[model samples]
Target: MSVDVEGKSLVDLLDMLEPAPVPEPISMVPQTWGWSVLALILAGLIILGVYAFLRHRQFNAYRREALIELAASDNNAAKVAEILRRTALVAYPRRKVAALHGKEWTNFLNQTSDNVTFTDGAGRQLVEAPYRDVKADPDLEILARNWIKSHKRERTA
Candidate 1:
């Protein structure tokens, strides 16, 4: 190693008189704004759900239609009652026939319409009517059959 003598070190230090510049500290802390953003996302999701509900007001429209076909093809009272209950749910969802059990189902059928005669009024069973009636509603039956035929023809074509 070459050694510098004290006599040679005097030239470089005398020319520099300015202080060194200091750097600003950069923060790397985690974000705290996620809660509000998450809440907004949740609100948007709720609005989208409400919009979908309004669009498809009747959840069981297609189900009732299919049940109607089953009742028509079978000409069974049980099938008719099931379809009627589905129709009732679509029409009056708050008074859901699907929730009925035992005697309540029978009662519901009697109270809802004279068009539907039930063995029991309160516990309106879905199927007992078709089996007991022996004579089905021919007008409704014909209409259902025609509807089924039309649908079948449309599908095939």
Candidate 2:
């Protein structure tokens, strides 16, 4: 069975039909201002954290150098003493550290560190080891390494 289109042509039928709706293109940009603001804040925080980490590493570079020198000294007491002196010079004022020697130097070492004692402990080697013919004590190297790693910075005021 078929219905007859007596008066209409194919072109006329096509033109009479409604056009299909076109959907709006989805936006790539964020819909809200708050989302954009949050993204910027997150980027800024990431940059700040990276900067702080790099500065911390740079500030502690002296400690890393001193430790390397200590390892290369091979338990030579004179070399160890020189390394400790040089490290102290970098950590403290030149005037305060440059003139210290013998017992004063040992006392300064003890004062700066909370855990290690240079006066009566293995650190005493620093005082007399360089001048005397005494054999190098392994403990002296360990003590120096500990002091170099953990010694507190001097207060500026």
Candidate 3:
């Protein structure tokens, strides 16, 4: 079945031809765009998480200090009242908080929350009690702490 090729066999002729060149090995190093984009997104998320953590700590710093002072007061009504006043000052304007007295001060405190009413409730003692040399009510301390923890900054008229 072989054709004559200058008296050489077809197999010999075929063998004399060069074999197809093997494709050059593909480059081993991967393309950088995909890896670079993935790394950038990962870095952004890490930075966002760190920022959120730091902002949260900063926001709670006031509450932590208020609790520490409340604990140190040790049932002293005058001291507790002073601490409350100082805490309020930080969150409210000086004029709005400075001149408040007795029922007015308690009313202001009550306005900030629905959970604790300072005027006609357990917190009534915060008014007259501070003026006298009386031991602070533990319940009032708890109420004040709760209010400080959850009170919104919006003032109620």
Candidate 4:
């Protein structure tokens, strides 16, 4: 069943209708310039933070290597002393560290580290270990590891 348009032609029917209202298209980009600038700054800061973290890890790679060598020394005093000296050379100037020996070396270790163990404590064994038949002292190993972990780096002018 249909209602017939008695007087209207197809062109007349088309002319009688109006166009539907169209909505504005939504934008995916941020609308405000401030928001865009803030987003760029935040992204740049994140990138900078990641770069700094990676550089810090790379700078401290020597510490990781020294710790590994310390672990592998098997509590041998001479080996522990050598490892500590090599680690010191990496952290300090070659002229200052390479020439250090005996009590002078122990004093230098004490000066660089937080604890005084290197001067009078278990670390004294480092001075004698290389020169004489010294027993492997676990405390000396611990002291050497502590020094390696805690020693301050020399400041460059």
> Model 4, residue 132: displacement in angstroms?
3.7
Which regions of candidate 2 are displaced past 4 Å? 1-29, 133-135, 155-157
- List the candidates' TM-scores in order: 0.32, 0.76, 0.70, 0.77
Off by more than 4 A, model 4 = 1-28
Per-residue lDDT tens digits for candidate 1, residues 17-44, read: 3577888887675367786688789999
TM-score of 1: 0.32
Q: What is the lDDT of candidate 3?
A: 0.82
How many residue pairs in model 4 have overlapping backbones?
0
TM-score for predicted model 4 compared with the true structure? 0.77
**Candidate number that wins on lDDT, 3 or 4:** 4
Candidate 1, run of 10 with poorest lDDT: 148-157
Candidate 4 lDDT over 41-69, as tens digits, reads: 99999999999999879877898898998
Q: List the pairs of residues colliding in candidate 3.
A: none
Candidate 2 overall Cα lDDT vs. reference?
0.88
Model 3 lDDT tens row, 1-157? 5555787887899987778989999886657789878988999999999999998788668878988999898888887888888888877889988999988999889887678778765688788766787887788889888888877664445
- Shift of residue 42 alpha carbon in model 3, Å: 3.0
Give the top-scoring candidate (lDDT): 2
Q: lDDT values of the candidates? A: 0.52, 0.88, 0.82, 0.85
Worst 10 residues of 2 by lDDT: 128-137
